[model samples]
Target: MQQGSVDAFGAPVSADTLKRYSGGAITVNSTQAITGTVSNDSASQVVTGNNAITGDAFSSASGLPSVIQNSGNNVLIQNGVIVNVEMKP
Candidate 1:
């Protein structure tokens, strides 16, 4: 993800946050399930489930577009931007 890109999860992340979590700048490497509410800030949020991290979140940072799978829906983030959100039927 690039700086200034807002993921489906709402607010424009701070530059520091972007630098910390951006595709190429990520430092940590691991896969972990995230449940409940995930938010970059008050304006941006995403509800996730046990399958939240199907892959390494940090490793996939440079993957451009990534999907955060959830029990309710799926969020698509491309180039650090929130491009599309798929709602469960």
Candidate 2:
């Protein structure tokens, strides 16, 4: 897999599983793009990346929250879940 190449999941991932693997922090390398579906249900999720996201990005429910940081250009985030997005320069 490339630095920022998006990959698909075989099935839906549970919150606990995702948290265990990522330790609540998911980082994307420079100039990377996430073009796959991201479903996070952890208590607190943080996604730090710098590049374009041309796919669906989702967070947790009201009880659980998420913080996503990425660039401001060519990023398309559309989901019903509520999350705090910080757009960097």
Candidate 3:
């Protein structure tokens, strides 16, 4: 896998899951259950469930949340950012 590259499954090599930003700003505002990596700049991901979700290679912590929770995997980072990753549980 490569940075910014898509896999045979058409998913980003750096992302197992990515909900896009809708308002041109990063935010924790998604309402879905994530069992995979989730990374999106200028978007919001609001967790509406009670699961310890993992994150993808997230970048520019300047635009991300302070504390994130994952079930059972170590989060990975690249270029001073998170890029490739896995899910919890």
Candidate 4:
């Protein structure tokens, strides 16, 4: 694994949460998972290696909407849970 950021509703993700997200699947485990956020002016971000998206409650910030995007990869909803997350205002 490599160093990167994980954002939650444009806010920086906690270090504890990053540890859980970067945990092992079976044999190999991620060495490091940094907790941080990208700048608001960022155009693109690339994520390599194993990734996990945990369930979290969503709240509107400044009365604006939140968006989550994934391209060219699989988005899994494991553990038989479906969260009704809206990506629009």
Instruction: Look at candidate 3 and tell me the lDDT of residue 13.
Output: 30
> Each candidate: what lDDT?
0.50, 0.49, 0.43, 0.44
lDDT of 1 by residue, 3-83 (tens): 665677555655676666545633554454545554554423766456545455577366455454445543433233433
lDDT of 4 at 59: 38
**Residue range 1-89, candidate 3, lDDT tens digits:** 75665567553432233333223343544354335554653424543445553576345456545564553334433223344333332
**Model 4 steric clash total:** 0
lDDT of 4 by residue, 36-89 (tens): 544444334656454454455343245444454444333432232233333221
In model 1, the runs with Cα more than 4 Å from the true position are 1-49, 60-63, 73-89
Clashes of 1: 2
Provide the lDDT at 18 for model 4: 71
* Superposed Cα deviation of residue 52, candidate 4 (Å): 46
Off by over 4 Å in 4: 1-9, 25-89
lDDT by residue for model 2 (1-89), tens: 54544576345555666656653445544443446554543433555457543445443236655556555434447534534554322
How do the predictions measure up, each by TM-score?
Answer: 0.17, 0.18, 0.13, 0.18
Q: Give the TM-score of candidate 3.
A: 0.13
